[model samples]
Target: MFELIEPIATVSFSKVVTEAFLALGMRNYWDGYFAGRAAPLGLAPAEVVHAVFYNFADGEVARHVPWVWGKTTPEEAIAVRERSSATVLRRGIGVLAEAPGLVRVADLAARAAVSAPTEGRALYAALRTLDVPAEPVARLWHAATLLREHRGDGHNAALLAHGIGGTEAHVLMALTLGMRAEKFDRLHHLPTARLAAVVDGLRDRGFVDAVGGFTDAGRQTRERIDALTDELAAPAYDELSADELDELIAGLELIAAARYKRSDD
Candidate 1:
């Protein structure tokens, strides 16, 4: 059971850091930044989000961003990819300036060692050297995004190795995360009839049962995917000694708790 410590810790850290994106995604200030940048390219919000955030196919983006499902053209998405990532980074910086835990997380990341070549660690290292907008919060959020992406990129790889496609992965996620299976279509922006077919296919593959629940085997498989993802992402934390890693995890937990606490209030 304790074998899962690294992945669990890493996932928690990633989620806490990535929460800023969600906060940023909701703010008009960040929206204006993205819209301003996208305007020059003649793309809509959905198109630019699908282009910049996800590197997969348009179909996958459709699965992730509900509004992008039928509203945007693949040609437009492809074209939006040509826009500079600096725009997103700038928007993120602006949002981070107003985020909680700004100085704390930034200071932690600045003191962290890049112990591995995992995408997250490398990105974190690179971001640390940038001009960083002359603001501590922006610098902090920038570093946090790199660390978040590292784990995320690794998770996507693990999902692929598990033979799960983009849509099916979200389906599994909804069910596994305790969301009602019936709500999967609505939540993931998949058509109900089409998602039912995907469900049928998953059932046939022994990943689900007649009632659309994970079989014991299915649960085990998902857990394995998570475990492997954690293992793969473990090297990124190699810079921290065991004690230091634990301390970092505790700090991240506090950050996450603050997020939930604020939401509750």
Candidate 2:
């Protein structure tokens, strides 16, 4: 049976983490850190709850501040805190107001005897079909659920990459730039044969010409993928409090920063 509490808990915890990061302009760091660590910690209901507070307190402090890398000083960190706090306040208001609707959607899904994937897809389609304002958030939740449910051997990441384009590198780049590398890595840890099959699927689709190469068709495919993701995420923005939005933006920045840092290493 589908557990309504699990999804709600996961979504709420995720939102909290995202909001906390935004307050410090450390969204990317949080996203990347969680992306890498979420599965390793185990995606259990209790684990999800524990992760929120733990990561919010420890992860942000350790990963987000550039001072750890000597890019900023103590005084600069204070200034960032002031600015990020204001942003967080605004985003929090938005997300709190919109959260009830999201919960309602989850409740509806729980009543169905569907699998999480099916429930998520149905929820996503229903959100769009019904013109719900939280459609974008719904889609993101759906994607997250799919990612979480299949977090081994890079299966989820490869599938998402294939859906976007054939080039695993490009997909990795996009996800790392937009999400987190740890998360990307978790989804792509497949054996050699499975990896080859994933690559072959992309080649067949003309989404990629090689492992790291992009075909003209692949570029077009990527464009479509971006469009769809954007379209799906548009509705959820309305529900985010100013704090949540800032956190999400910050998370994106952190992911970008982490990606660059990795490249530098």
Give per-residue CA lDDT, model 1, range 1-265, as digits (tens).
Answer: 1232222222312333333233434232233233322232343345545544333334543334433323334343322322223233333334443556556545554344233464433323333343333355444433444455455556767777888765667767877987755675534555578778878888988989888888887788789988887787666667666776676566555555544454476
Worst ten-residue run, lDDT, model 1? 1-10
Q: After superposition, how far is residue 245 of candidate 1 from its true place, in Å?
A: 2.5
* Model 2: lDDT to the true structure: 0.37
User: What's the TM for model 2?
Assistant: 0.30
Error of 2 at 110 (Å): 22
lDDT of each: 0.50, 0.37
The sequence of per-residue lDDT tens digits that candidate 2 reaches over residues 1-265 is 1132223224423444445434444445444233323322223233332332221222233343332223333334323332333243224334432454434433333222122222223222322222212343343343333323322112323335445323354343534355432234433444556446555666787855654455678666666654554444333344455665455545433333443454476
Off by over 4 Å in 2: 1-184, 210-212, 239-265
Residue 31, candidate 1: Cα error in Å is 8.7
What's the residue-level lDDT of 48 in candidate 1? 48
